[model samples]
Each structure stands twice: as C-alpha cells, then as structure tokens.
Target: MKLSVIGSGYVGLVAGTCFAEAGNHVICMDVDEKKIADLKNGIIPIYEPGLEAMLKRNVDHGKLTFTTDMKHTVHNSDIIFIAVGTPPDEDGSADLTYVLAVAKAIGQYMTHPKIVIDKSTVPVGTAALVKAEIQTQTDIDVHVVSNPEFLKEGAAIDDFMYPDRVVIGTDSDEVGETMRQLYAPFVRTGNPIIVMDIVSAELTKYAANSMLATKISFMNEMANLCHRVGADIENVRRGIASDRRIGKAFIFAGVGYGGSCFPKDVKALIHTSSKYDYNMRILTAVEDVNQDQKTILIPRILEHFGGSVKGKTIALWGLSFKPKTDDMREAPARVLIKTLHELGATLKAHDPVALEEARRLGLDKMVTLCEDNYEAIRNSDALILVTEWLEYREPDFEYMKKNMNSFAIFDGRNIYNPEKVRSKGFTYYGIGRQ
Candidate 1:
C-alpha cells in the first residue's frame, strides 16, 4: 500500500518509517522545507533509539521518501495519515488547528476517493470534525478513520513494530478491514485488532494516558505517606506489586510523570469531560497531585541546608524527563533547577543525551551543563539523582566523597540504597526510605 504521513514530527516520522520498513511505499510530508531537506540527507530531527538506522535503511531501499508538497502527497497515497501535533490551549483543551488545517488541505488536493486516518491524538468527535472539514472541499468519497498512535518516545520503533493491540475506529467494515490488513504484520502474535466507533476510539487514547498518569500520582502520594510514617516505599511497592490484580508497571515512585502526553492529556480529558457537563473529579486530583509531585524533593533539599540553598553548589545527575529520551517537556528537573536557582544555589547538571536539548532550552543560563556525569559532581555540595538514568544507578562513592565540598546524596528516584551511601561516609536522603 502507498501511504503519506503528514507532519513529519515524532509520531509521523516513526509511523512513516515503520510503514516503509514493513514493505509499504511511504512518503513523509511536512510543511517545513528545511526539515524535508534534512530528512532527504538522512538527518533525523528527534533522538529516538533505533529510529535513525531503520529510517536510513528504508530510504536506502527506495521504500521511503520525504516531501514538502501536499498536492503530491494527497494525489499519490491510498491512505493519508494526519499525524500533526494537538498542543494544549490556554484553557487546557487540545488545540486542533493543525489537524483541521491538514484535513482541509487533503480535501482540496484530493483527485479521487482516499482513506484519511486520524493518527494524531485528538479530542473525542475530532474525526467527525475532520470528516466535515474534508466534505466542504470536495464531493469525492473519503473515509476518515480514527487510528490514534500508542507509541512511546524512547521505545517508539519497537512499539510500532510490535503493538500489543491495534485500535481502528470507523463506521465502515471495509475501512476497518483495510486498516486491519495494514496492521496485520505487526500483530501476527494474535494481539487484538479492536474495531470500534470513532468516538470511543478517540477517547481511548486519552483514557489510557490518564490511567497511567493516575497510577504515577497514586504511587507518589503513597511514597510521601511512607516518608512521614518512617516506612520504605520500595518495600511497600514490593508488597503491593506482588498482587496479580495490581501488577506493577507505572507504580514506581518517582519525582512525577512528564512528557508530551500525560500532562496535557490529563488536563485535556478533564476539560473534555467538563464540556459535556460531567466533572472528572478523580482525574482532576490526578492532575493536581502530579503538579505538586514535580517539586516533591524541594522541601527535603531545603531542610537539609537548614532552610536555605543559598550559595550551595548542587549537582544534578540527570536532566531529561526519563531515561533514553531527550524530551524535557514538563520535566521535574526543570522545576528543581528553577527553584534552586532562585534560592541562589549554583547548579551543575549532566545527562547522557539531553545536554544539547537543555542548552537549546536556555537551561545553561541557570545551570552549568557538563558533558561527563562525574564532572557535574566536581566540588558540588550535594548530588541529586533526578532522571534515574542507568549510568547513575551505581557510582564511585569513594571518588564522590573525596571530590565534593560536602557529602550529601539526594536520591529523588530512590535508585540508591541509603544504608550503603551512609556507610560510605556521606549523608544519604532517599524518597520514602527510612
């Protein structure tokens, strides 16, 4: 099948590349001429693992191409996927300006019937809006299918190549079958291909993200309670995670959840529910808890310094939201850095891959970005583990003790053993570890 994926951002790039890898002729279209030119020269914008190699292979094989021409995209493709971003509005609802604009362009350039899939995460009833927008431009028959992506940032290639389930939203059985055939290679292991109405399909993406966000908030809440009660969150996590019903996935206590998805999706769901005159009270709490949880370590750090981080030199072990991705949207480290900087703390930070992104976001003005992890801890008063990167899991404590102006370790992700750090002649503070 010939396919064109509009908006060659994260989702569009991965989806288009994966489709091409699966033996489909794919053209990834973007309005940015520079980006399309970069893709043509084998330059990928995002830093997703395993993506560059796969995209390059498909391009080398002539299975994939990049273009800035929308008319060519609409005319040559049997299936066109709208993978544009739906960033949150000031009121927290998803802004569909990009998605609707793509739909209008597709309608205007259509020469015949085509299948348009809503691959971007949009609000419920967005498929209807897309369909109506397209109808206004042409009388040619068009089938709009809601096929929301479930790809994770760091592991997007694997997730696309082997999805647990494929959800296709359409009223037509023919469209459903067509989508199933397109996704059939990925789900050969008998994972479900769920076909449902457009409304349910749109809601599924929000519901799935909100539930994961809820789990993260709930665990963070529990970790805070454990800290007050002189209990260990790790032990509590182990105790509860043993139960098969509440199996462990997103239950680990951390600073908070952040990315392109959770923060906006939770707010969007709450906003969407309110529009229907129904309040999502639980989701509202989930959003509230997550916001506060981002700064969960501030009080501990302040108290450690007798209510002042003023003139203290603190080292941060990680800068990204999580490991293996350079995305810093709503990263907890940003809040920590901002607060610490305001309190006159000199900051030194390092991440395996996010140093350039941090510099691009102007974080270098507030904190010194270091290339090596050990270089970040040099002469620092305390070391704080922020993102839980694998390299920070085990460290040379002897060197840390000798090089630091002070000896204190604040384990935000609870990846350290408090007893071992204390034994190394350094003070150790861990979340919910007592």
Candidate 2:
C-alpha cells in the first residue's frame, strides 16, 4: 500500500515508520521544510524507545521517505492519514484547526479517490467535519475514516507493532475492509479490528485515555486519604490490586498523570459533554483531583523545612513526566519547580534524557540541570524523587548523606522504601506512607 501521513509529528512519525516496516511504502509529509530535511538525514525529532533504529532501517530499505510537497503526497498515495495535532483551545475543547487544514489541503490537491484516515485524536463528529471540509473543495470521491492512534510515548513502537485492538470508523464496508487489511499485519495475534460508526470511533480514543486518567486520579485521591489516616497507600494498593477485577496498571499513587494525551483528552471529553448540555461530574472531579495532586507534596516540603523553603537547596532526581521519554507536558515536576522557585528554593534537577528538553523549555532558568544524578543531590538540603526513572530507584544513600547539606528524601513516586531510607540515618518522607 502507498500511504501518506500528513504531519510528521510523534504519531505520524511512528505510524508511518511502523507501516513502512510492515511492507507498505510510506511517505511522511510535513509542512516544515526543516523537519522534513532533518528526517531525510536520519534525524529524529522525538525520543521513543526502538523508534530511531526502526525508522533508520525502514529508510535504508527504501520503504519510507519524507517530503514537504503536499501535492505529491495527495497524488501518490492510496491512503492519506491526517495525523496532525489537535491542541486544546482556551475552553478545553480540542482545536481542530490543524486537522481541518490538512483535510482542506488534501481535497484541493487530490487527483483521484483517496482513503483519508483521521489518525489524530480529535473530538467526536470530527470525521464528519473532515469529510464535509474535503467535499467542499472538489467533487472527487473521498472516504474519510476515523482511525485514532493508541500509541504510548515510551512504548509507541511496540504498541504500533502489536496493538491490542484496531478501531476503524466508517460507514462503508469497503472502507472497513481496506483499513482492516492495512492493520492486518499488526493484529495477527487475534486482537480484534473493531469497525464501528465514525462518531463512536472518534470518541473511543478520548474515552480510553479519560478512563486511564480517572484511574490515576482515583489512586491519588486514595493516597491522600491514606496520608491523613496514618496508613500506607502501598499496602492499600497491594490489597486492592490483588483482586482480579482491580488489576494494577495506572493504580499506583504518583504525583499525577501527565503527557500529550491523558490531560488533554480528559479535558476535551468534559468539554464535549458540556456541549451536549450535560456535565460529566465524575470526569470533572478527575480533572480537579489530578490538578491538585500535582502540588500535593508542597505542604509537606514546607512543613518539614520549618514552614519556609526560602534559601533551601532542593535536589530533583527526575525532570520528565515519566521515564524512557523526554516529554514534560503537564509534568508534576514543573509545578514543584515553579512553586519552590517562588519560595526562593534553589533547585538542581537531573534526568537521563530530559535535561536538554528542560533547557529548551527554559526550565534551566528555574532549576539547574545536572548531567549526573548524584551531582544533583550534592550540597542540597533535601532530595525529591519526581519521575521514577530506573536509575533513581536505588541510590547510594551513603554518598547522599555525606554530600548533602542535610539528609532528607522526599519520595514522590513512592519508589523508595520508608524503613530503608530512614535506616540510612536520613529523614524520609513518602506519599501516603506510614
């Protein structure tokens, strides 16, 4: 299949590369000439585990290519995927400007019948909007299908190569079969290719992400309650997670959920509900809980430091929202950094891959980026574990005790054992840990 993905961003890059690896000729198109040039030279913009290797291999094999030519993209491909970003508007609704713009361009440039897939996460009924926009450009026959991506940032390559299920939204049986054939290589393990209405398919992506965000918020709420009741959230998590119905995935108590998907999708879903004159009460609470959860450790840190963090030097072990990816969108560490800086706390932070990104985001102004994790803790009053990077799980407590101005560990992810840290002759504070 000759496929063209419009928008060489995270989803487009991964989807195009994976499709090329699966024996399809893929052309990843972006309006940015510099980004297209970078891709042609084997320069990847985002960091996903195993993506660089796969993309390079596909490019070497002549299965994949990058281009900035929109006319060539529309004319040369049988399937055109609109994988652009739908960033949230001020009102929390997904702004469909990019997706609609791509649709309009495809309509103007397309020479023949084309299957346009909505690969970006857009609001419900967006497929209809995309179809209408394309129709207004020309009289050419076009099949607009909704095929939202379910790829995680760190594990996108694996998720694309082996999806749990593929959802295709279209009214025509032929369009559904065509999509199924394209995704057949991935769902060979008997995972279903669910074909449904366009609106349902569009809503599926938001629903899935919102549910996961709800789980995270619920666990964070539980963790806060445990802290007040003098109970350990870890034990409570273990107790509940043992039940088959309450399986563990996003149930671990963390600072909060953040990324490109969860926070945006949750808010978009709530906004969509309001548009229908309905209020999503539970989802609204989920959003509120997550917002507050980001700053849950501020009070504890202030109280521990004699009600003031001014002039205190704090060490942050991680800067990214989570491990194995450099994405810091809505990261809880940002909240901590901002609040602590306002309190006049000097900050030193380190992440294996996110230092440059932090610097790019101007976080270097607020927090000092260290190349080494130990270097971050040196001479700091307290160490806070923000993101649960693999390296931060176990540390040389002896070195921390000797190098720090004072010995205190704030475990935000609860990755450290309270008894173990306290045993090292240092004060330890863990979220919901007794």
Candidate 3:
C-alpha cells in the first residue's frame, strides 16, 4: 500500500515510520522545508527509545521517505493520513486549521479515490468537518476514516506495532475493510480490530485520554488528602489496586498529569460539553485538581524555609513531563521552575533526555541544566524530585549529605521511602506519606 502522511510531528512521524516498516510504502509530507531537509539527512527531531533506529532502517530500505511536496504525495498515495497537529484554540477546542488545510489540499490535488484517515487526535465531528471540507473542494469519492493513535511518547514504537486493539471508524464497510487490511499485520496476535461510526471513533480518543487524566488527578487528590490525614497514599493505592474491577494503571499518585494529550483533551472535552450547555462537573474538578497539583510542593518548600525560598539553590531531578521521553510540553517541572525562580531561588535540573528541550524552551537560561544527577544535586540546599526517573530511585546518600548545605529532599513523585531517607540523616517530604 502507498500511504502519504501529512505532518511530520510526533504522531505522524511514528505512524508513518511504523507503517513503512510493516511493508507499506510511506511518504511523509510536511510544510516545514527545514524539517523535511533534516529528515532527508536522517535527522530525527524527537527522542523516542527505539524510533531513531527504526526510522533510519526504514529510510535506508526505501520503504519510508520524507518530502515537502504535498501535491505529489497526495497524487501518489492510495491512503492519505491527516496526522497534523490540532493544537488547542483560545476557547480550548482543538484547532482544526491544519487538519482542514490538508483536507482542502488533498481534494485539490488528488487524482484518484483515497482513504483519508484522521491519524491525529481531533475533537468529535472533525472527521465530518474534514469530509465536508474536502467535498467543498471537489466531488471526488473520498472516504474519511477516524483512526486515532494511542501511542505513549516513550513506548510509541511498541504501541504502534503491537496495539492492544485497533479502532477504525468509517460509514462504509468498504472503507472499514480497507483499514482492516492495513492493520491486519499489526493485529496478527489476535487482538481485536474495532470498527465503528466515524463520530464515535473521534469521541473515543478524547474520552480515553480524559479518563486517564481523571485517574491521575483523582490519585493526586487522594495523595494530598493522605498528607493531612497522616496516612500513606501508596499503601491505599496498593489496597485498592488489588480489586479486580479497578485494575492498576495510571493510578500512581504524583504531582499531576502533563503532556500534549491529557491536559488538552480534558480541556477540549469540558469545552465541548459547555457548547451543549452541559457542565462536565467531574472533569471540571479534575482539571482544577490537576492545575493545583502541579504546584503541590511549592507550599511545602515555602513552609520548610519559613516563607522564603530566596537565595535557595534547589536541585531538580527531572525536567521531562515523564521519564523515557524528552517531551517537556506542559511539564510540571516547568511550573515548578517558574514558581521557584519567582521566589528568588536558583534551580539546577537534570534529566536523561530533556536537557536540550529545556534549552529550547529557554529554561536553560533561567536554570542550570546539568548532565548528571549528582551534578544537579551538588551544592544544592535541597533535592526536588519531579519526574521520578529510574536513576533517581537509588542514590548515594553520603554524597547528598556532604554536598548539600541542608539535608532536605522534597519528593513530588513520592519516589522514596520517607523513613529510609530520614534514617540517612535527611528530612524527606513527599506528596501523601506520613
């Protein structure tokens, strides 16, 4: 199959590369000439664990290609995937300008019938909107399918190659069959391929991400309550997770949920509900809880230092939204960095992959981005655990005690045993442990 993917962003790049790896000829089209040129020179912009290697292999094998020529890509491919970014608008609804633009371009340039798949995460009725946009350009037969991706940033390749289930949304069975064929190789392990109406599929993506965000916010709230009640949220989470009905995943209590998906999706869902004059009460609270949760450690730090973090050198352990990916989009660490900086304190941060992104986000000028964990903690007043990277799980307590002016640690992710750290002659603070 010849597939053309519009947008070489995170989702588009991964999807196009994986599709090409699965024996399909894939042409990824993007408007950014510089980005296409970089890809042509085999430069991968983002850091996913195994993506660079796989993309390079596919590109070398001639199965995957990148170009800025939209007309040629649309004219050559049988399946056109609209995987452009739907960034949030002012009202919190997904901005559909890029998706709709691709639709119009495809309509103007397409010479044959094509299956236009929405590989990007968009709001409900977006497929219909894309369909309408393309129809307004030309009356050519086009089947717009909603195919939302559920790949996590760190484990995108595995998720794409071995999805738990594949959801294909289209009004016509003929379109569904074609999608099924495209995904048949991936679902060879007998995982189900769900086919449904296009609108439902679009809503499914938002609903899935929002529900996961709800879980994270709920857990963070419980963790905060645990701090007041002199209980450990970890134990409580363990007790509840044993229940068969409430299987454990995304239940870890932490600062909050942050990324490209959860924060935006939750807001978009709430906005959509408001459009119908319906209030999403639970999700509204979830959003509120998350917004506060991101800065949950600020008050603790202030109280510990007697209402002033002025002249404090805080060592930050992580800069990414979460571990194993360099993405810092909506990262809680950013919120903490800005708040701490406003308090007249200094920040020295370390992450396995996000140092460059921190520089790009201009956080490097505001704080010191270190290459190693020990370097981040050296000479700092306290150690602040943000992302809970696995390397920070165990550390040389002696080095921390000797190098720091104060033996204090504020754990936003609750990554340590409070008693154990206290036993090391240090005062340890966590989200919900007493």
How much lDDT does each candidate structure score? Answer: 0.93, 0.93, 0.92
What TM-score, over all chains together, does every model reach? 0.98, 0.99, 0.99
What residue runs in model 1 are displaced by over 4 Å at the alpha carbon? none
For residues 324-386, what per-residue lDDT tens digits would candidate 2 score against the true structure?
999998889899899999999999999999898899899999999999999999999999999
Question: How big is the positional error of residue 275 in model 2, measured in Å on the Cα after superposition?
Answer: 0.5
What value does the lDDT take at residue 72 in candidate 2?
91
The alpha-carbon lDDT assigned to residue 150 of candidate 3 equals 93
lDDT of 3 by residue, 131-157 (tens): 889988888889999999999999999
Give stretches of model 3 more than 4 Å off: none
Model 2: runs farther than 4 Å from truth? none
Q: Model 1, 235-323: lDDT tens per residue?
A: 99999998999998888898888888999999999999999999999999999988998888889889999999998999999888989
In angstroms, the error of model 3 at 261 is: 0.3
Separately for all candidates shown, the number of backbone clashes (residues 3 or more apart, or on different chains) is 0, 0, 0
